[model samples]
Target: MRDQEPAPVERATRRLSTKETAELLGVKPETVYAYVSRGQLSSRRGQGGRGSTFDAAEVEALARRNRRESTPGSSPDELSVRTRITLIDEDRYYFRGVDATQLAARHTYEEVAEWLWTGTLRPGARFTAPKESLAAARRAVSALPEHSSPVDRLRVAAVAAATADPLRYDLSEQSVLGAARALIPTLATAPPLLRATYTDGAPIARRLWGRLSHKEPDEASLRVLDMALALLVDHDLAASTLAVRVASSARAHTYAAVSAGLGVLEGPLHGAASGLAHRMLVDVLDRGSAGLVVADELRAGRRVPGLGHRLYKGEDPRAQALFAALEELPAAHAALAAARDVVATTARHTDLHANVDLALAVLTTSHGMPAEAGETIFAVARTAGWIAHALEEYGERPLRMRPTGHYVGVRPPQPLPTQTGRE
Candidate 1:
């Protein structure tokens, strides 16, 4: 017989480097590692066992899964909104293309707010509440029950302030800007002050400090609070931000748009996380260990608050920035230690990281503020973001945010049930 054909040689599967895998998945290399740690994908040592490599086919399959999960029914281009204000990519975020943490480090909250609103950093920018609006907001907030949450008080204040402004219906950029400037300060000063030393014309953070705590604030503490506000000024299209945009798409005035956002913020998953974190920290401090507290939270089927965020695969950038600031304050040492302990204790079970809520809890607990103080700070700080979203939405087509309903319930034409006659 003619020379037997050589048996076909088996070929090894193709492998991809980490950089290639990340590019294929449309994420950063860190995110690729995060996926591996989470068990969503698998990796093997490359030739000579030098670097991890992913199966090429496996990476493509994961890319498909991610696309399916992130955009379920609609295409990304259709469901997404174009925005020039904030961009969250990888684990870091930006405000107007500038690093948000850097902005918070270099500028006051007012200056950052001005930059977000107009794309220009106005040094020494100041926002003053209109006296009439402030008085009306305070009156409305005072009428609520004593047990009303800070967000409740804020919603009432927004409505009251709206009534005081006769030109709220005017959607002109200048008019909206005017309303935004007046409304933010009005909201900041509307809550009942805990101390009698409240001073007008101070920065928003300074004014807010008197409302949240009675203790005298040191300059370092004040710096932390100011930076917190600046850092929290906006987070791109959060649940509350979406509400504000939807309301604005319907032509709601600035105050109403903000009120719509506040309504959504009161949910436990959104704005109340810091308060839960505050309570958890208190529990950890009292029990003298994070292990027991973490176990109890898991046993109760509740997620450990302030631990992880949906948008971040690594430590929250906001938390990182705030933690660095918190390190300088002597008073924050105990709470800061507790937060770290909590993170370490939880890491054994999950790959989660500390989020902004944990940092806020450290601040509030260390400064003698009540649990609800974080919610107040969030509501006040996010109002600026709500206004900015409202301004952008105003320029879009009216009712552009309205989504078509997908009826998954019983199909439309069921026979009407005849009412039974009572004997």
Candidate 2:
């Protein structure tokens, strides 16, 4: 297939904010959108999803562009991001052009990680942690305060792993993958909460399960955990992945790039998505009425977390596959009931559908794990993806992700009018 064409030039005029664009077009702010939807104008999403910015040149030539008249079902306005990693389309997600849901069924997490990093499926890839690396991670985790969250322990472990590796400075594809193979497992096993005695050479999913829960997880639940890890291996250029690529583009080592990704992943708007969803599920189970809880949240003008996603027009396929898996487990019965009720109730009141965060929340809580367990799983799984992105970015021009800011601050060298000497 041919490469996607570049997005329209990102000229200075296109960088105008909503208010500026509205004034430029001599129309109300709302009407500016009417023009965009009609394709008379084009805009791209601004940083951090604050809003869209219009093309100044395109706005100036709007009359001429509109004369051609677009066909009934033309492509919607979108930013052209070039990558061979993952694809999100029509409510489904694919990794390396393979359906994620289908791949999750028969593939182990390590296998998927190999495929993402190398572009070929190697079923028996081993992601082994060195004894010395594990020791370093433990020391790092111990240095944190006792009350640190599991994710905090993970961050410290990442730094420790990087510092211990003398060869981490190499940025070759094989070198980066080798660093990632050791680093991910160290992060997973280093956390005090997840630390436990296990035989060497265990599958990552089984070893991880021992750390998350005191009870031994059944074989079926282990399979579920494996699938969850595999499915979350990548998701295009999410905010955290963007951070990884940015750090890599600047020639940072694999460890430094991953540290940047983890920093962004901890934000409430990113990796914490599953934790928030878990709280919503807890509220329903505690209140004994899913409908009442949903209604109250909506009445208070708060969004019911995990019920909707910006990417999927219908139910997130990941959620659908996970919910189907939950159906076969007796332990998930109560949590599943509450989850389904929330899904149905929200459907009646809004266009939102259940997303992957909700599915992950249900999976953890229903299996008698802590509410924060989902985030831990997410962090570990996404580490592979972050490494994959960092490798991809290392091949591109350096520092390309660095964006120039439109200065809206006060002008330089302006005199203070009050003569208070405040510059």
Q: Using lDDT as the measure, which candidate wins?
A: 1
Model 1 over residues 224-341: C-alpha lDDT tens digits? 9999999999999899999999899898999999999999999999998999999999999999999999999999999999998889999999999999999999999999999999
Q: lDDT (0-100) at residue 207 of candidate 1?
A: 88
Each candidate structure's TM-score, on Cα atoms with residue i matched to residue i, is: 0.82, 0.78
Candidate 2, clashing residue pairs? 13-56, 14-54, 14-55, 14-56
Candidate 2 C-alpha lDDT tens digits along 287-306: 98788888787899878878
Cα lDDT for residue 301, candidate 2: 88
Clash counts for all predictions = 0, 4
lDDT of prediction 1 = 0.89
